[model samples]
Target: MYPSSLFQALLLSATLVPNVFAQSSTTTDPTQRAELALSALQIWYNAGSGLWNTCGWWNSANVMTMVSNLAKHDSGNAQLVNLATRIFANTIVQAPAKNPQPGVESQSATKRSNGNETYDLFNSTGKESGYYKMIGEDAEPITIFPKDWDKAEYIDVKNLPIMQPKEQVTTVAASNPNDWLDGFYDDDLWWALGWIGAYDVTKDTQYLTLAEGIFKAVTKAWPTACGNGGIWWSWQKDYMNAIANELFLSTAAHLANRVQDSDKAFYVDWAKRELDWFTNSGMINERGTINDGLTNDCKNNNRTTWSYNQGVILGGLVELNKASPDATYLPLAARIAKAAISELSDSDGVMHDACGPLCGGDASQFKGIFARNLQILHDAAPDAAYVKSIQANAGSIWDNNRDEGNMLSINWAGPFIAPANASTHSSSMDALVAAISVN
Candidate 1:
């Protein structure tokens, strides 16, 4: 169970922590800081490819979404626009919406060359495409389905799933804690949203088409398994996470607004269906915040209230209302946004997640998604509190979170520690870039 009070939660956290570090200090600004931060981030870019080469392909997708958002908000930032253009042109080798390579390189080169090795395999979902893994930093490639013959999810490389044009899966399964949803449904959700973000920036119908196709594939996979509504986290189809469903709803609604005239109803219907099922799915707890997901038994497993869970549904609801002009959507979105600000924030109002100091490859991406959506809420509703919270966190991101190269190493309400990496930096970039756009 979660702590009933913020004070109780903080006390539990402090007592549980093994050690604490002093806070870092730096000066702050929103727009200027975002620009300064990007200058530092560009160091991670690979000149060999226009991609932000320092991170895994998934994180690089997030980086692209962030760059596009930055360009959209800060129209005067010519460099940001140029970066987006370059990435779109040169990143053909990266796909769902990418080009396939045809060279004779080592497995290491192939995986990294594909730029699709975050979870480490191309066919992450068993129902998805591609069929290989790159082990460790050497980027060694191997087939994904050979742990044991008895496993149901395992399949030989030669028998890979026949994928539709939009059903591109990247990343690999892991054996560490087990590789159940490495190419998680949520991952496709992220990729779909990233493609949408790219579409929003470029206005190229190809990006929109790619997103539409991905959405089509995702909707086709909506399961009758546990409760007959939510999409499974992966092809393994054991547990369903809240984030994936939220992304599903958001993607559907977002696409409904973006697609060509005839296709609008298809996506809009999906958006409504998903939102209806999700709200009643028992994931939303009594405090009005979302739980992580359902247990194998399909009951509310009562996981932690992640900032992203609270964050994502807000955007989904807002978009749902925008697409259909329903009275329910915006108010629901506003409620979640209000709950997130009240519950998930620290005394200083910067967002906080319990999974830290190192929230691993995935959780690193959460708060920025939160910030980006919060900006969305502010945009639709024009709340003073929302804008101020965004600006404060955005500015403080520069002040407290900055490390050696201005890469924000986790802990949004921070005494920042840990070395910076592409995931941490690029995710935080979303929040800072959002600050510029909120007003």
Candidate 2:
């Protein structure tokens, strides 16, 4: 579970999703791009494991949508049918019979408080006994850390548990189903993406059924905090959880459109409200470098801009663009995309995993966000500037991050730790695919 070939291969979709030269009356050349994207997708499907490299689950869903919709266009990527089917089967098998436990809540759960909107599940050291290994062979509580992996002294596994007041736990506010809703959100995003892709591919309603089930779970678990209904920053409010709101908003919109059901208005409205809350309160400084979370707001905790947060929001805005075509969402997305291109890079051409007063994480964390930014830039503004930017960054990411060892190292591992960093790598992967298809 070191590095995944899946992302490296599937990234071809980034190149294909944006339509640089499509005219109002002309059909785009989806065949060559589809082939290129599928070629990369095929590599991932064959190589991914049930764990560590489970992006096979996500990427497969995307490819299925692609084939189902684009197949009629030049019979796109016929070989992907078998591969997507198998990956779907594997995803079903890999899904836990029950959701994994997030981890033991903080040792001393505080009583609720007024105007106290967040909490922490892990201590400041970022240490815990939760299982995070993709192997899924051992049954330990899932938390920031898994039990049976190599440990470094610098990597503190057993430390104090951090908790905000009990009120901060809003997903299953009355009852705790699991901690942080980590992989479950991934489930939500992918299910909706699969539904849309399926519709575009086959116009089959059954895929809608699958997608609806996912939406139901997501809505049931959606958080209501900060005077807005949104997902938390993380299990621990101190680290980063608010970004989940952005992921949820876009996912909810996709559901609303895909189902065409008036019943989901609450979910869609909730998404919009949270988006507003985030943009109004969470953004820090004039640069539009959105804070990681509330703590990041006061120049504490993670005082930097995270790629995943921006990526998920950008992805959400694109969906919002499709839903309403308003400047409110699109302009904000464009501004952040430009800021990311400028603020996150350095003289050595290395991307800081995060940017701000307090920023520290692995180099890999930045790759998905950077890729996603390039992707959205191309999708939203497909001129030479956007295309050149995407191509340039894509080359750098592919050259620097990819490893032949395993897709887990490059793709899976980063996404596995998405919550801690305030990025939605797993979800962003789906958006990256969506961006590619447009091209």
Best by TM-score: 1
C-alpha lDDT values of all predictions? 0.63, 0.42
Q: Candidate 1, which ten residues in sequence have the lowest lDDT sum? A: 101-110
Give the per-residue lDDT digits (tens) of candidate 1, residues 303-388: 77778888888888888888899888888887788887888787888887766666766567778888888888888888888887
Question: How well does each candidate superpose onto the true structure, as a TM-score?
Answer: 0.73, 0.59
Q: Residue 79 of candidate 2: its Cα lDDT?
A: 40
- What digit string (tens of lDDT, one per residue) describes model 2 on residues 60-161? 343344444334344344344423433333333333222233333323333343366543233333333453322112211122333432221221101111
Q: The CA-based lDDT of model 2 is what?
A: 0.42
**Model 1, runs deviating above 4 Å:** 1-29, 47-54, 95-183
Off by over 4 Å in 2: 1-75, 97-99, 102-111, 115-129, 132-145, 148-225, 234-242, 296-302, 346-366, 397-439
Tell me which residue pairs clash in candidate 1: 95-98, 108-139, 119-172, 120-172, 121-171, 121-172
